[model samples]
Target: MKNRNDKQGNLPPEIPHKKRFIIFLSVFAFLSVAVLIRYAVLMLRPADTENTGNTKPFVERGPILDRNGRILALQTRLGNITVWRPDIIDRDVLSRDLAPILQIPAETIDARIESSSADFIYLKKQVEQSTLREIENLKAEGRLRGVGVEAIVGRIYPEKRLASQIIGFVGNENNNGLAGIEYALESELSPASVKAKGGSGNQVFLTIDSNVQHILEEIGERIRRESRAEAVMFMAMDPRTGDILGSASLPNFDPNDINSSDDISRMDRPAIWAYEPGSVFKVFSMSALMESGSVNSGTVFVCDGHYERISNRGERVVINCLGAHGRVTIRDIIIKSCNAGAAYAADRLGADAFNELLQNYGFGARTGAGNPGETVGYLSPTSRWSERSKPTIAMGQEIAVSALQMVQAASAVANDGVLVPPRIVSRIVSPKGETIRSYEAPEGRGQSRRILKAETARAMRSYMVDVTSDIGTGWRANIRDLSLAVKTGTAQLIDPKTNAYSPTDFIASCIALLPAESPSLILYLAIIKPKGDSYLGGRIAAPPIREAAEALVDYLGIPRGRNPQISHPGSVSLPLPISPVVDAVVPNLEGYSKRELLPMLLREDLHIEISGDGWVRRQAPPPGSPLNSDTVIILELE
Candidate 1:
């Protein structure tokens, strides 16, 4: 409302140019101070924002050990080299220094440091300690840019190829578990650290005994070499508890370099592959008969080498008998491996009862042993059975079974009619050596089912022992000091295209229980498609059984039948000095039977080659020369 001159007068007059500049500078200084105070407060306060990116490296993984506390697998510290590209002072100099130590191309290192996009890049992982030391020396010289090393856990196997399939292996990234126990118990064995910030690590304890595993692998290798078979699988278990002591499959791959192996060789054959078990299956057929109360061990049947079909399907199935066994009891049938006898028994016990008994024995079913890729063998339903199915199945054809199933089923018989579920993992121990989890032996099949009486098992065991004695098919499996009860099987492989048996290919198998009366150990060995030799199980598989039994007896320290009398150092020889048998030239014992050669060998106190069936064709230590008592004589048979 006032006059314009009066309102203008209320405001100060315009300053000189220099004075105005000072005023402007004063305002800018105040604004700058305010900005600086805000920035300082922001920097001084703790960051509320989460890091979102974690930098601390991995914690160590624990060990995988066998039942004997032997290290099967372990994790060791390894060095990984990484670079901070932005921090790299001289890319060329760094490349020059690191190229030789890291064994990487110099160009690769130079390119990595020159790249503007990467904040951090890995140069090398799992570098050995020695290589890491070399890299550190370059870093001290100020020529290795921003390269830094972090310790990482690397998986390692002490026993290279032993039990490779069963133990499995880890992978490239962080050495995480990939297969076998590594895959099965990944979470439990690799737990997050207690800090809840890194990888969890713990020890996994397996039921496998490393010593037993070594023995099994050694014997399996021997069998594969001797039989020249396509593949061989051997497994041993504690019959009382179904604890697998050892499992070995030939053509094994070293887990340390698993990438070099084929997928087939990497598979755990004993648990994965299924086959048509031959005469060895007679035990189950016989058990089915006894379980149904239709027959006993004394049940007898006449065997004329073949069984004619009574059903109207016009299916005439031939039951091949090893020899003409006359009227034979169930025990005799099993011991003699008479196919006709088994067919008769299956016919006597109807299909329904037979199948039920098989089911009760845990056949045609998976054992659920917690192994990866376990096969539940094929067992056709009752409705699907053909007219010849009964006899064919009784004679060990048609039904397919995994080696693990055979072992588990036999465990029932060995455990006195109570089946115990097999297990590979014994327990899980924490990193602190405290037990985190313990696996107890699982109970047998069903609560109400009883497959056979204790007396029946004992009687069957006796008959089984007879099979390894003079009169039965498994006589070749006899051990020197231990009693071996074994059954031999030679299964014909069916050609899918022809829908018929292949003449040349056969699966030779032998299953034995040592100390036949009360078996503590049960062993099963199978040689698939053996070549360049006799394919009979008695010839190819029995010898391995004997070797395994002998090795096991020594390993377990089982008291020998008769301990050798210890001689005192100063003890004198008998008054009448026993005349030492004069060394004689080795004899041509080819084509001679055990009976024919026994007396001669005893008279000369000579060691003899007495393996396989039939007469010998070749002999070691040519005949008619002075032979020392310590000399071993080899015999060849045609």
Candidate 2:
């Protein structure tokens, strides 16, 4: 009994019901506060933690623009039309309604859905906005059940096929670049996050001018079709700044329909295709010879239709020429394109010195113009030279060079002996038009290195001008009022089976620098494997140079040298004398020549309307009236 009473007392009085409830409330309040604090910490953390995993949030890619701010390639919203077979009530009705909008036959759409192994199938991909709208309207009207549009980010080339090879195309799966500038600058064009460092997915502006590119493409296509050539590559560049204005490769593809094009049609030939440059190489060879002190303007070499050299092993090496240009100086060699003269001049230098000189001209290196698949071309070291290698190379054989290399090398001549590295991209700009980086070097300042002496360049240019003169090989390139320094080449292709020059296959090409004395523009064009009546460079390739030069001279507003003065007869006599206006009244301008109306034309108050050329034959208001604000002085001249 005592123990029971003591134990009950030891419990120390039972807590009040209100106090116990208060204790429970306190413990719950602490837990609630802790949870609130934890949530706040999570909300304050930086978003970078979310990307710690393998997945990343997609960001909008930037656009590709031309130098003039023309949109070439851009990110666009396209929809993939999808269908769920389980949701479909009537397949024929759905296909019929979507056929016209999708530009596909109803039967084709039915077949695609019928042969599907899964419940869902894509009706079409990359559907245009206009077509997507039509489908959406039908869906909203409850016409096509189970049909849906899955929104996706896609690329569209606004210019279509204009510069397809340069712009390239994006892959369907991940929207990654597959080729061209799209692939070359993928990281810059596509960003991982909105807050990416350096610059956000910025706009890539190319040096290519759409207007000039259009002109080159138009001309290249014409030449390709007419000459029946395998392909054609044309390019234009600002020789001083090394900005490639236009690079056109014929047989181009429409990036919008990339699957329709093959490998050959999609190649950027100007920067990638390497071939023997034929007589055009003579320009560089001659320049190298002059720079090495091996030959001068006055040095003369005899050309008896062929160049013959005897090796120490009693081997006779003979190189044939186009013709016998007798007693020819270096100038004559350039004008006539004499292989014998170029070979004899090259004979004066050692193989190592000649190879070094040629390398300095950018023959064996890539121009780095930003095109994918660019080739460095081929130029073996002097140690690999055979007995006839020197003379053969001198005459434009046993060496291969890309079109870009040729353009880069010619820039030295056009820029007065300085070699400027070519650049295709002009700048990287933000989406808001902020300049992030500039690729164009300031005028007269860039990565320029001297390749030839100033005087040597001038001499070479002068000799090249003679090539467009009456007696030279490139005379067909001459323009009426424009002065152009031109070089033409016709190289025979090597047959794979024979391993020798092919008699039927040839590459005809021409290069021109307008305003020979102070050149500003350089244009190069080549027609590969021209199967025409005449494959000679002078006959086929030179004419296109003249044609392009004329268009460029007009488009670029380049000065067309000096025009011949023409004597004009004095002003013709009018039928009647003009009367002077007094007190703000209309004057009798009838029968007065335009020259006599010079003062009246400058009056701000009078609205003068004059038509035709000779003199005022008829005057409105009968030639005598007070001038008013609404009165237009209409003088009909004959």
Candidate closest to the true structure, highest TM-score: 2
Worst 10 residues of 1 by lDDT: 563-572
In order, how many clashes per candidate? 5, 0
Per-residue alpha-carbon lDDT of candidate 1 for residues 9-51, written as tens digits (9 for 90 to 100) = 6543464666889999999999999999978876776553223
Q: What is the C-alpha lDDT of each candidate?
A: 0.76, 0.82
Could you list the CA RMSD of all candidates, in the order they appear?
Answer: 14.0, 14.4
> Which ranges of candidate 1 are over 4 A from the true structure?
1-54, 79-152, 193-199, 443-450, 562-638
> What number of backbone clashes does candidate 1 have, counting pairs of residues 3 or more apart or in separate chains?
5
Give per-residue CA lDDT, model 2, range 422-538, as digits (tens). 888998887677898888672444567998987788778867877876677898888866668899999999999999999999999999987675678999999999985789999
Q: What is the lDDT of residue 406 in candidate 2?
A: 89
**Where is model 2 more than 4 Å wrong at Cα?**
1-58, 83-119, 138-147, 193-200, 442-446, 562-638
